[model samples]
Target: MLKWLRRSEPKEVPAATLGPLQIVKPWARSSASEPDVGGGYMTVVNDGESDRLVSASCSAAGSVEIHAIRVKGPALEMRKQDAGLVIPPANQQILKPRGYHLLMRDLASPLLAGSKVPVTLVFEKAGSVTVDFAVEEPGAVGHVTLRSS
Candidate 1:
C-alpha cells in the first residue's frame, strides 16, 4: 500500500554547519624528558556573534585545563581560567605562553617536540571543535612552527 510505503521511508534532514570558531596556528610544548605535562597555544577566531570556550580535552593527557597567566610583581603566575575564555563578537581569543594557555596534566606518555596532538574545545554557542596542534621546541621563536593545515 502507498500509505505503508510512505511510513517506512526515511525522511531527509538538513546538514549542519561545523561551527564559527576557527583555530589558527596551533602548537604544543613539552619538557625534554618523558613529559607528563605540557602547554598548548593557538588563536581562536570566532566568526559567530559570540561564544565562550567552556573547556578543553587532550587525548594525550589525562586532564586538560584552561589556564591564564598573570604578572605577579617581578614574576608571572599561572592558574586556572576563571569563568571561561570569552570570544567576543567577531573577535579573537589568543592562547600563548605567558598568557592564556592550556595545561595538559597527567599525560599518559611523553610529548616530544615536533609531535602533533589532538585537542577538543567546547564552546557555549558554536559547540565542539577538534583540531591538531604541531609541537615545537621549548625555546622556539614565538611558537612560529605552528600550522593549521
Candidate 2:
C-alpha cells in the first residue's frame, strides 16, 4: 500500500494528570441509529488523593454528562450524576458501558468508527483534562487498545 494512502495512527495524547489523578484509556462508542446520542468511557486513576469528576464537555455534542445505568425494574434507566463521580483515593474510577459513562447528547454529527472526539473532564481537585476518545464500533463492548509504537 502507498504510504500516503495508508491511514496514519492517531497520535497518543498524554493523560491529563494533576497531583494524583490520571485519565487513561479513553474511548467512545460510534453513533449508529441514534445520531444524536453516544457514550464515552475511560478510567480515572487516583494514586494519592480523592477527587470528584464534576462535569464534562465535548465540542461534537451540545452537552456531555456523567451518567449511570440503574435497574429500575425489568427495564434499565440512565440517570445523570448531578453531583459528579467520586474518585476514591488509591483507587480508580471506571467509566464504562452499562455502568458509569459519559452521556453525549445533541451531537453535531454522528460519531463514526475510526474517528475521535475530544472531551474535557472537569475535576473538583485535579482541575480538568481534555482527552481524545477513539470512536469504536457501535456495538463495541470495550475500548480499543492503542498499540504502543
Candidate 3:
C-alpha cells in the first residue's frame, strides 16, 4: 500500500509597507440611486512619530471630501470636516459607512462592483500613497480589507 502526502497551498499576502506609509484596509463603493456619490472607508497607521492624512483625491470622482455622518432628530446628515483626518502615532482611525468617510462626489463615470478605482491618499508626513479601491455594492459593509501596505 502506498500513501500520498498532500502539500498545503500558500496564501498570497499583500506586500507590506508602501514606501514610508502603511495603509490599512482601504475600501470604497458607490451609493444607491446616486452612483456618482461614492463612499470610501479606510484606516491608516502612521509608524512614524508624526503624520496625518491631509487630503485625498481620486480619479474615480470629480471631488473628494472627508465627511462625517450625523443623526439629528431622525434626520441623517453628512457634513464636511475641514480640519482634515488625523492619524496619530501607533493609533488608527476608522472610516466606515454612515460615519467618517471619504465622500466621492460627481463621479466622472459609473463605478461598478468588482472594479478597481485608483485613489491617492495624501499624508502630511508620509507623503502620498496611491492604492486601488475594490468597488462593491451599495450599503455593503465589512467588504474592505486592508493590511499594512
Off by over 4 Å in 2: 1-14, 72-74, 140-149
Residues 1-149, candidate 2: write the lDDT tens digits: 65667788994444667678878889997546566888999888888788899999999999998888765445556778889999999998999876889989898887888998999989998888788998987873333221222
Q: Each candidate: what lDDT? A: 0.74, 0.81, 0.72
How well is each residue in 13-132 modelled by candidate 1, as lDDT tens digits? 212223776787888887444367788888887667888888999989998888877765656566687577898878788898878888788888767677889988788888887878
Give Cα distance to truth, residue 16, candidate 1, Å: 16
Q: Who is ahead in lDDT, 1 or 2?
A: 2
| Candidate 1: residue 8 Cα off by (Å) | 55
TM-score of 2: 0.80
Scanning candidate 3 in windows of ten residues, the lowest lDDT window is 140-149
Q: Which candidate is the best by lDDT?
A: 2
Least accurate stretch of 10 residues (summed lDDT) in model 2? 140-149
How many residue pairs clash per model?
A: 0, 0, 1
